[model samples]
Target: MHRGREAPICTRMSHPLVFDRALLRARQARALALGPEPFLLERATEDLSERLLTVKRRFETAVDLGTPTDLLSRALAGHPGIGTLMRAAPLAAGLAASERTIVADEEALPFANGSLDLVVSALALQMVNDLPGAFAQVRRALKPDGLFLAALIGGGSLAELREAFAIAESETTGGVSPRVAPFADVRDMGGLLQRAGFALPVTDVDRVVVRYGSPFTLMNELRRMGAGNVLAERRRVPLRRATLLRAAEIYAERFSDADGRVRATFEIVWLSGWVPHESQQKPLRPGSAKMRLADALGTTEKPAGETP
Candidate 1:
């Protein structure tokens, strides 16, 4: 229990996880509505794998939690970053031959405690309902002094799109159901990691601005990349033609750069931490500091009560 807080335990990885299923379904539905494309999550996994292979050449054993499309496996086949390690699960056949064993949930990883030297998560953590529990699970899976790396969309992402829509809706009608979903702020995420008992937690932001010809074109790309927002208890009404047109006008007029292209912001928050190690210890010697009794009285003499 926390010292002064009465919030429910936010660190359980038990059965029937608490993620917003409606959100997931809504995202799925939105993706289907837009076009045929895999979610941005899969791409995140691939990018994470590539980064690990590129920088951390010393780490041989690594795991990618929620790996979709066997991205890590394929990356391992060639330059595979610097380490060039092989995937634990080999590809069998077909397009997904490189697909590794699928773990059911991130809240409870299958690996034994202290087994993994490194664990990487792509864009999947945002979808996790029980984020604290998920972090605890990651901590348990890591070896002593092991490392964990991850990337997730930050709160600052898509500010332009969100604001444009907000203003347009207020001007045209009363207000419309918000399209973009809320994301974790860097400070909140850092606190969650600390609460999960992760040590040396650090976060950095990656602001990616994607240019689009129009709001519909931007929506099309999001659908293709499967990056639509998913929120529980989602509003089901279709966006009216007027709303779309107004949104585009607002986007172009307000969010357009000097180049006259609409800019969509994506603030990717990257974080890394290491497992706390019991071995980093130091024993104190008894009576390490001597009492300079003579100097106490400013006369090179012990006080009357001194036993030395």
Candidate 2:
């Protein structure tokens, strides 16, 4: 791996910090220690690996970025097309001593410019405060035509929990505090990729709905996944018992099914882009086509002022 000076952390944005990254890291470490459920990370790894299979090119150097578990790295291990797949975690606790792992922050990657052939992240990057800046750094770190593919928790995730909490808090305490981390929307992702100077950017969402016995069960799973509310503006006071009970009741009333199980939605937004290269496809310049649209379609041409 090509090592460079640690990239400066880009935390400030036009808006205030949306996440408490330090707290998030600590929670993630604790979750790991507690043997958090691996279902979500496993699903993301499978999807990302399948997506990589569709591309025929071999990557001489690649990275797994900050996935909480080693599932992604292990899945890619011994893949014929991948030469040296390194795993990077935000903290040391997430690293495996037996594997080629590095402690690197998503916001401040330590890679040299144009040094990587590919970068894949699964179920990470959503907590980043300066997401655009992180994307820009990833773009800068990739060789021309190198690919960046990631799956992160999207905005549609936990809609039920968010709504239930809001209504319950309002009804019980007269106000609602930030209880969930804000996620990235799929709609703005393409523009973010373009802004980061990546070419052929593609973004899509995979919505997964998991059913649980109750809202409390789902909340416990989230904490075990290290994805509990870590908002910088989150309420420091513990949630009132009345609010918690009310939220559970509201969740059951609104989101429960025939079997009396409640649903939790997780939207995994997949993003992919490439560093620009001349060999890649390019859009035709305006008025540069040899065949006119009318000729190609075998239809009569109509002027702007004339109706067809």
Candidate 3:
């Protein structure tokens, strides 16, 4: 909780120190080697594009930070409100087609202060080591009333896989090692948006369930998407074949449906907000409203500090 403003927001705070930037980059490059299946990226892009279409706010210039695939570039081009759009990738530098695609890090955004009308990130911020710093940078990069929209893997994602890995490791190696990266919950993420100074922030989780033949198949997809565990506390040694096989068994036994296909969860958390501006509506302070709840609701109401 925070105080002292019309809308409460936290100051500079803790970084997500668990993620490894170098490993994340390496995995991202590795994923690209499989030539872009892009199922998740496409879904994220569609959701983002749909949300943008509903908003009345017209952005003249926009930036897609930490673009995982080329889908974002096309998504931006379809929206008529944006005049220009830039794609910033993490691994590739200065790849130009029609729009400029420059390599950029999410932890350290390259945009000048108040330089953008809109900043959109997809499937990118989850790997950022300093998420607070990254959000703060996004807030700073926006002009007054500039909008920010992003979608990332959320806390509810991949629960079955994480549990199976832990149980298998504990049973096989007599120890538990981190096999999945933790994600922030939507409620907590809403606070983070405000912590980064976003006004009227909104956060929600969209849970997606996909069925696979086995956990190993799921792992292959995650690897191909460059979304595998890159946690600093992850096991340094390779996973034993016996342990991997056991984990697969556990996953199938626990998370599989009657049809024998195992379920995998991908909870996409969408965070939306805008820079503070005079034009936006704000909540009135306590006791400052012209009308009372009694009048509005047509009922007898007792004032606070009075017990009736």
Candidate with the greatest TM-score versus the true structure: 2
Name the lDDT of candidate 1. Answer: 0.64
Model 1 Cα lDDT, one tens digit per residue, 232-306: 544567666777788889889988888788888887778887788875443558767466545665666756899
Better of 1 and 3 by lDDT: 3
In each prediction, how many residue pairs overlap at the backbone (N, C-alpha, C within less than 3 A)? 3, 0, 0
lDDT of 3 by residue, 166-217 (tens): 9998999999988888887887888888988999999888889999988888
Clashing residue pairs in candidate 2 are none
**TM-score for each of the candidates:** 0.70, 0.95, 0.90
How many times do residue backbones clash in model 1? 3
Which residue segments of model 3 deviate by more than 4 Å?
1-16, 92-99, 302-308
| Model 1 residue 66 distance off true place after TM-score fit, in angstroms | 2.0
In model 2, where do residues sit more than 4 Å from their true spots? 1-15
What lDDT tens digits, residue by residue, belong to model 2 across residues 82-145?
9999988877337876558888888788787888899999988998888898899899889999
> How should the candidates be ordered by TM-score, best one leading?
2, 3, 1
CA deviation > 4 Å runs, candidate 1: 1-19, 22-60, 76-99, 278-308
As a TM-score, model 1 comes out at 0.70
Model 2 sits at a Cα RMSD from the real structure of 2.0
